[model samples]
Target: MPNLTITEMNNLKEELKKKGYKLTPQRRAIVDTIIENEGKHLTVEEIYDEVKKDCPEIGLATVYRTILLLEELQIVYKLDLNDGCSRYEMVHKDEIHRHHHLICTKCGSVIEVEGDLLENLEVKIEKQYNFKIKDHSVKFFGICQNCGE
Candidate 1:
């Protein structure tokens, strides 16, 4: 688990500018919402709710479009799971995108875990099973602590 920093945000904004992006006031508000909620992976609806506080005229469709643009710019990453709407997090992966998470099925709680758990398994599949693996995503689902109670 890591925190999003102002420095990273600055870099992202600069990157966006280099790519001919104009930061509209509404878009800035949306990006602020995402940073203010660093570790909490948020869906478009959730982001729109937060963005609305700053830009009352902002629409859900605008949020969706902004999210898609940011994702294309690699300023955001979309999380894929078997359930629920897509959630997004801001990340700049210059190195290995090496994080996995556990998701609670009942309450939709997400817990971050590290340390290349799939590395050895991927290697074994390539060697023993003769399967050349490019990449993989794994998300375990179960009842979370609060939900279990």
Candidate 2:
């Protein structure tokens, strides 16, 4: 539901320009597709399929390369569900750390947990180990409500 605002889009364009990367039509289409499917955590193929609807000439390799570039720019990050394929989601500037995920083992549905649920644990670990915690990713796999029902 957190789609990129117009201001965010402009900022992204500026960032790309600063990095000597042009936001070409194909790249824009790829970015728009990702923004439109923000919570879906789409794979490169899925992104290609959706982008193809708007840009029939777009290639799978192009999507793959663009995704890599976006990831490199920290505009997006890959989420591995331990399901073989890699999925991608946007990088929220406001997030101190990546949000957690609730993955349904039975139905394979994914739910995002927006709240940072590991703050206490992080504090304990930092105190115990004398290490600075930058960020973390947590995935809990279990039956979802629908599956439990």
Candidate 3:
């Protein structure tokens, strides 16, 4: 989990205010959970369960709605590992690029691959097709170490 500084939290609050959205407790709780579990690639149910630990009154619908709002604000990114559930991770503003995913088809485990694995490919594509790439997402599916045995 990435450590969120006070300034970063304030920036997120300011962003919400600028978008004409108030930072409600429920929304804050959801964001806190995501921040605390940065690289987990949590699903809606997983988020809901974590939020419930502190605020038992928090409902699943609230978690879903908050996630949508976060996604719209680009504070969180949605991921599809092709395992049926939609996973999410915090958007690290300090990072220059996003990471890739390694998914185990048999066990449904997702792993994060850091660094820009597509930099060379993006550059080649840009030079060949005259198209600039802003971002990309890749998911490699195969049997995990435990499952391969």
Question: Which candidate number would show the highest lDDT if scored against the true structure?
Answer: 2
Model 2 RMSD to the real structure?
2.0
What ordering of candidates by TM-score runs from best to worst? 2, 3, 1
Ranking by lDDT: 2, 3, 1
Task: Name the lDDT of candidate 3.
Answer: 0.86
Candidate 3's displacement at residue 142, Å, is: 1.5
TM-score of model 3 relative to the true fold?
Answer: 0.90
lDDT of 3 by residue, 1-149 (tens): 24358898798889899889988888888888998887788899999999999899999999998899899999999998787889898888876677888888888877788887788889899999999788788889888898985
Q: Give a tens-digit lDDT track for model 1, residues 16-132.
A: 899898877777788878888877888899999988987899999999999999988877888876666798887646525536888898877788776668777788889998988
TM-score of each: 0.77, 0.93, 0.90
lDDT of 2 by residue, 85-111 (tens): 999988999999999999999989999
Query: Which residue segments of model 2 deviate by more than 4 Å?
Result: 1-4
Model 3, residue pairs in steric clash:
none
Q: Every model's Cα RMSD, please?
A: 3.6, 2.0, 1.9
